[model samples]
Target: MSTSHDAALLKPGFTDAVFEAQAGFRALLDALAYAGRITTLEVSLDPPAPLDPATAAIALTLFDFDTKVWLDAPAAAGPVPAWIRFHCGSPIVSETHDAQFALVADARHLPGLGDFDIGEDRHPDRSSTLVIQVPALTGGSATRWTGPGINGSIEVAIAALPEGFWAQWDDNHALYPQGVDVLFVCGRQVIGLPRGVKVEV
Candidate 1:
């Protein structure tokens, strides 16, 4: 009764899950600390289809038994969810609001920032973190970012995001310590956008 999808779900994760996840975790930390700066993930992984290597690596690195994840339609119905379940032991939730992390494989259909969890004033760390996959990490329309991590401002490019992304970000930024943070993945590169950062298109 097993299908090809089931078989794919059984595939091994990173070649060295612990070490690879550790390295990826460090890279992600640096990306977030620097805000708009692009950080490359040099982890070896054989991720399931529809889940890019960078995205997959991040899931493995960040999620644990205590975390809950929400995957987009394409990723949820595929082997990617099962792969994460097997490797990361993170529960996959049906509601975006319940997720600690939301994996958006297609940027075009990304959910509005308000739809996800924006932690309450008493516990701001409860907010969801978005891991969005994009076409390219660089060479698109420029967006100027400024806030805690930058000296003055930094211009970065991210290709193929949903329309009104910046408008939504404006609202998200206004939430201050309660807003969700984002990590954009393209190929092996990742760029972070923390809640405190301001983005001008």
Candidate 2:
């Protein structure tokens, strides 16, 4: 890891310097408990270009030298990946499964979510986690969500989701604990849908 002044300054003071980052992490956890729910987090400064508020927030929270990232669109070669490298120090990988963090610049271009890692039988949590940066989400999607965090079902209108994504996710649910978790970033809002949650059309 580079320890130069610039790199050291890039290190998030949130773990020690700022309190808002910790708040964002907590809000993120709560949002994931209920699928498709939205939560807004406050950021002290604007993130680099091609980055939304939620994306910047997460880059600060989960990334480090230990993490590997995969980029879906905008090719991870320009300002997008460079920002991640400068701030997070996460390695970029060519393979999706090898990545601990995957950033999708445009949601429409996102691959079938199931094409990514779904974890494993022994250590299911090892699956790749995705960060999908979408254009806009008016009211989330009307995918009836039911599971641990919800009572009965909750309706949310998600942004543009890929074709047959639900069917593949249904298959993934069968795998139980061994599946991927996804985080959606739009502007400064975020929501998480872990594998444990069930989404029905």
Candidate 3:
């Protein structure tokens, strides 16, 4: 646990915490409800190093005492973890499998989707949700997506992910009702890719 003085050294959470969190939560819901579609998040907060505004906002909105978070190397160091502990009150875990939500600062070096909790057949909703920070939301290799939330087919692009990201995602998609979901964040934008969604590069 971080002391109050340690937390005070980090950047604060949203200015209008309650309202901002509510608005951010709505944006997150909208993103997930329309998988593969990018949604804009507007939350006023200066998060610590390694945490983008969108990721930080999502953390504040979705995480609570009930959730366990896993922070990647960069995010685990410095004041970022302390800030999350102070604002979200979610326990930060060391193992990826132990996390309900995982935050990765760099998508290019992100671990395989299979590394996280995929949940059981009867409780697929308990699977881990990964928040990955990408360079940009658009202008990269395009991938086609089709799933429940998507009406038909939609093309989406994310910049600078590792080489085998799509391959790993393909394997994850094959898991159907038992795989981790993903949220790609860049700047103040966020896009969802639920476990059921199929992606074709």
lDDT of 2: 0.74
The residue-level lDDT of candidate 2 at 71 comes to 86
Task: Tell me which of candidates 1 and 3 scores higher on TM-score.
Answer: 3
lDDT of 3 by residue, 34-61 (tens): 9988899986667788889999999999
lDDT of 1 by residue, 1-201 (tens): 345677554767788777888899899999999999989999666678788889988988899999999999888888777788777889999999999999999897689999999999999999999999998988888999999888899999999888899999999999988999999998788999999999999
Which residue pairs clash within candidate 1? none
- Show where candidate 2 strays beyond 4 Å: 1-18, 75-77, 139-141
Where does the lowest 10-residue lDDT sum fall in candidate 3? 1-10
Point out the higher-scoring one by lDDT: 1 or 2.
1
Our model 1 lands, by Cα RMSD against the true structure, at 2.2
Q: Score every model by TM-score.
A: 0.94, 0.86, 0.96
The candidates, ranked best first by TM-score, are: 3, 1, 2
* lDDT string, candidate 2, 1-201, tens digits: 444764654424343424766777788888787666787867754666666767878877778899988887664644656667876778888887787778887776677666778777788878888888876655545678788888787776776777777787788777779877888788888877888888888
Rate residue 193 of model 3 by lDDT: 90
**lDDT of candidates 1 onward, in order:** 0.90, 0.74, 0.90
Would you list the clashing residue pairs of candidate 3? none
